[model samples]
Target: MGSVAVPSDMPATSSAEPSSGASNSPNSPSAEGSGNAEEEPTATPPSPSDSMAPQGKVTALRLADFKTRWAGGEGWIARTDDSGKSWKSQLEHKHIVNQLFALNNLEVWATLDIGDSKQLKLLHSVDGGAKWAEIGYVPNYSFLHFVSSEEGFSGNAHTKDGGKTWSKLPQPAVIAGDAYFHDRNNGWAVTQNKDKNTLDIVRTTDGGKTWTTVLKRTTAASVTGTVIRSAGKKDAWVELIGDSGMSQTSYSLFHTMDGGKSWIPVLANNQAGSGPAPGYKTGQESKVPSNTGSSPGALYVVNPKVAFMGGQCMACDLPNTMGKTTDGGKTWINLSSKFPGYGTQLIAAADAEHLWWINTDNAEPSIIYTSTDGGEHWKVTHTFDKPQPTTE
Candidate 1:
């Protein structure tokens, strides 16, 4: 009852289209809806460089139906009780598994990369993974939130005790994107201002030292990415990726009950302000169907109104679906076209009807879909094996 933090693919900030002086009005200024200071506050735009680079691949998390845990290719880490048929490894490092976490089943965590070298590290496992240790070195594309087993967070660094020790988080996160806390003092993030290109949705009660900017956006679109999901205390769900020119690639889902202060636009392009959240309405927004290529793909929320999303663009060859929004997100449904082609790379929801999907799009036997009626129905709960390929 404490393992949920697996929405990868962050690093977004691009928007140079909606202009004519811009003001698509979701609150306009491009988009803004923070506490309000009577508008007008734009100037600090720069110092925003990009490139976090993790993207190793393959990630998984499933709490029951036999338990589960997985990391990516090279760095490895595995587990499966029966639901996935079989698996065991638990740890084998060199550099790959960019992110993975499982705060419950005995606690587990991972982050190890090598691509750009920056040489990252931070791996731990209480027991569910059998064994794993190396708990230090982080920050290269940081985005981890531990919650227990010693407290955590790795980006702005702050460890209560676990990762051996660490500290320094005075407000400045967005090592590219992605961050969710819900415990050590609430949280929410999706930042990137790179000098006004815009993309913000920040909040922090006290844990992050400071931050406040309920929502803001103006990335126009060229190629963007972001993913966030939350459940209890004020709900949360954000999945954005733009770039709707010719090559397509569009997606924008936003929801935040009260936690982030304000934001509602279930799936948008411009629903004005969209509806539902304390209260909001205009058109009702629902437009996520562009070329579908950029890839931000995957969301899991299971509280303030169920959730489960999917993704795949494989360069826009398309043919990948899985969406289910009980009512909170306003609307959504397309539970994978009756199980066809399998795509949704990762999702885990142990409640609100139970769910668990992980289809590595064929990275050596990966499919493991399962559902308990929240996704309308799903099957195919068996298949595993994916780490074991290191030749270097």
Candidate 2:
């Protein structure tokens, strides 16, 4: 089953202390000497091996493996420094970690879902998960997006001083859900106006100080937009989920070039006139019905023109289809025959050529597959085993 982008279904305990070391103190000596430190006594700025040298390489990607299904379960965050060659778990928690935002190897943020309570706990690890500090809590939030170590947005709240403090941004007429920040100042967010019962896409150019609605649902369907991925301030993709209650759930893919001012439907199923036009069927077999249970599964946008789209079967057991577009979304070449299994749960693109996908099949163990030449060839990089509890 497709995982929901909500809080986990388990309870989370604050494993680490309340950040009492000098690291968490903003007025500590480290903060004062951070940017204002003078040259050393030898008239040379500290050497590369000096004690003040930066720690660790930039973390390329982080993966959270939950011991159980979608909800509350034991999980750990694994970090890979040299692409996906080797990995090590940096943080182990007693609860399910739904999302992770890694600014670097040492600075990361995670959202822990405390099941049943419908609450969320935000944790921050500055020492590469060696120690975690409870940053904040929210009743509900979709995911966390960090543009930098100091700036991030979750739900409708923004954190400027890392995760030490947060401020609620003014909401539009609708209640905001998922959010994405491409940079420190430019971003996009999804909102739903409960009073009007409509979904809207909003943009922020000056951080979260101001916002403007660029796309709104004009149809009667209850639409929810979840940001799939973004390449920059202008190029981004969003998955629109239309819930008709008793009717079958509808999925459509939309892309925006001029920020959120305008959007074009690149691929959709069963929803007519939603965008350009419905593309080819994304099921395993041609006779399985086009776009019946398909949704935007994994999306990797290399730029405004080159992008890869993976179609997922949200409500059915049909296999997924893969496609790539070189001329933006105008024309797509189906590449489903290039892979062996269904589409992946997540897609991480190191560049236009190097990509990674996590395959979670019901009958087999979850495995990490890598494709260095786009999607032409694939190799198994890692396979997940049952997690064993580790002593902190």
lDDT score of residue 313 within candidate 1: 46
TM-score of 1: 0.31
Q: What is the lDDT of residue 97 in candidate 1?
A: 71
Model 1 has an lDDT value of 0.53
Q: Which residue runs of candidate 2 sit more than 4 Å off their true CA positions?
A: 1-73, 82-85, 116-118, 127-134, 175-200, 204-211, 216-220, 244-248, 271-293, 314-318, 337-344, 361-363, 386-392
Of the candidates shown, which would achieve the greatest TM-score relative to the real structure? 2
Residue 20 error, candidate 2, Å:
47
Report the lDDT of model 2 for residue 124: 83
Model 2 C-alpha lDDT per residue in residues 140-215, reported as the tens digit of each score = 5655666556666665566777766767665454544466655556667767666535667778888677888887
Report the CA-based lDDT of candidate 2 relative to the real structure: 0.50
Model 1 misplacement above 4 A: 1-83, 89-130, 133-162, 172-237, 240-321, 324-335, 338-367, 370-379, 383-392
Give per-model TM-scores: 0.31, 0.64
Clash pairs for candidate 2: 9-71, 9-72, 9-115, 10-72, 10-115
Clashes of each: 6, 5
lDDT of all the models against the reference?
Answer: 0.53, 0.50
Error of 1 at 2 (Å): 30
